[model samples]
Target: MSSTGPLQPLTEGGVKHAIVGTLEQITIALAITVPLGLACAVFLNEVPGGYARFVRTIVEAMTALPSIVAGLFIYATVILILGLEKSGFAAALALSVMMLPIIIRAADVVIRLVPSSLREASYALGAGQWRTVWTVVLPTARSGLTTAVILGTARGIGETSPVLLTAGFTAGLNTNPLSGPQTSLPLATFSLVGSPQPALIARGFGAAALLLALVVLLFVLARAIGGRGPGELSRGQQHRRVLASQRDVVRMSARRPVPEPAAPDPADS
Candidate 1:
């Protein structure tokens, strides 16, 4: 339906392929990444001492590692060793590894952001540490954890080099991760932009825009549902305010004066 040249038809196919591939890759990446990332975060957040710092340092370093490095590692280890050809599943695994540190750090930060007083209160109520973390910490910081996972997924979805090297560029739709050439959205854009067709370039732009839209959608959706509710407003801000209010109340009560002795006591003195 586009008269904009040969680029147009090529682009339509590219867009369709990119959208489908990206979605498939993201689904796989999230499934494996979220639970593991959160688990790592829980350990780091709940545990104390120099050990946590060591783990945090490792995660922080991993977060900044280049995408190509992750791709190479996966290619050599999983692809070469397993004798599996480049596939979407491999790409997803590569992306998940790259994404893990981000989600873990984000979730750990959120868990730490939970009020110490809340933990104390839970303990006061005879809750065990594990129970407190499971029931209190997680519920309170659920939104942040969800947002972290979503953000990690969004970050992974845009990966091009990893998908290119691991997933490979294929012309047809592939739903199965275990076999066949699967074309992903980023790889599609990378492949299409090099073409001399203006229509293809436009399609690339549209695809890029769509990818951005998806990321934004996920972030907003996750943030909206994270924490208590959208109506609760900023969870961190609310939590801080509540803490301050409690402190003020405590101070006020501490300052309250006891009743003066009766005049009869003064007469006796």
Candidate 2:
């Protein structure tokens, strides 16, 4: 229907605009959420006492906050107060807000699971708190962190209300997220599927299928990249292991007993 149909909405750009808009929203949301979430997680893990607990409680509360609420919050704060136009950035901000709590909580759990002994070992090696966290704690929790990020992405990408409220959907492709309207997959699907025309409905289904495929691809790529945990050696780690083995061999060879008995035996013969 998209190829030969009379529906301009479906066949005009072949849903490329929707695809690009979804990618833009997800990318921008992740870019904002990941570092902030990780930092929050690290802070929560490293800090002790009532303040951390209070913050954790707040984040946990936010985890249950409705997507619509998030959208409204951004709409009021960013769009209304800041006088910013409805664009992909506003949508991204909403999505980021929705994603942040999930990522932070998951990351906190993962970082906490990182053995305390590793942190101790780093400190024993004269590493400071920040250095230990950066080098030891984070790498140890890398796989779990990746999982947290993926989970957040999955949740944010599927949300329609927030994007609809903030993004102000457009049919045409708008690459610049900061200016003009953008239409994500979920928003596009919702808009198209709501149409009275059958061709538009078919295109909506097609857009939904495309969104599903994109999500699957992201999941696969994330798994492939993050499947390896702390126990698995990367290329640099393998090289370092090889170099250490060579050093050990050299040290052992140097410490081996010299052959004074052979000379004595030859002289006796």
What's the residue-level lDDT of 218 in candidate 1?
77
Pull out the clashing pairs in model 1: 143-226, 143-227
| Ten residues in sequence with the least summed lDDT for candidate 1 | 1-10
lDDT of 2 by residue, 70-177 (tens): 999999999999999999999999999999999999889888778788889899999999999998899888877988899889889989999999999777779999
Error of 2 at 264 (Å): 3.3
- For each candidate, the alpha-carbon lDDT, in order, equals 0.81, 0.88
Q: Report lDDT (Cα) of residue 134, candidate 2.
A: 90
lDDT score of model 1?
0.81
Best by TM-score: 2
Whole-model alpha-carbon lDDT for candidate 2: 0.88
- In terms of lDDT, the best-performing candidate is 2
TM-score of each: 0.78, 0.85
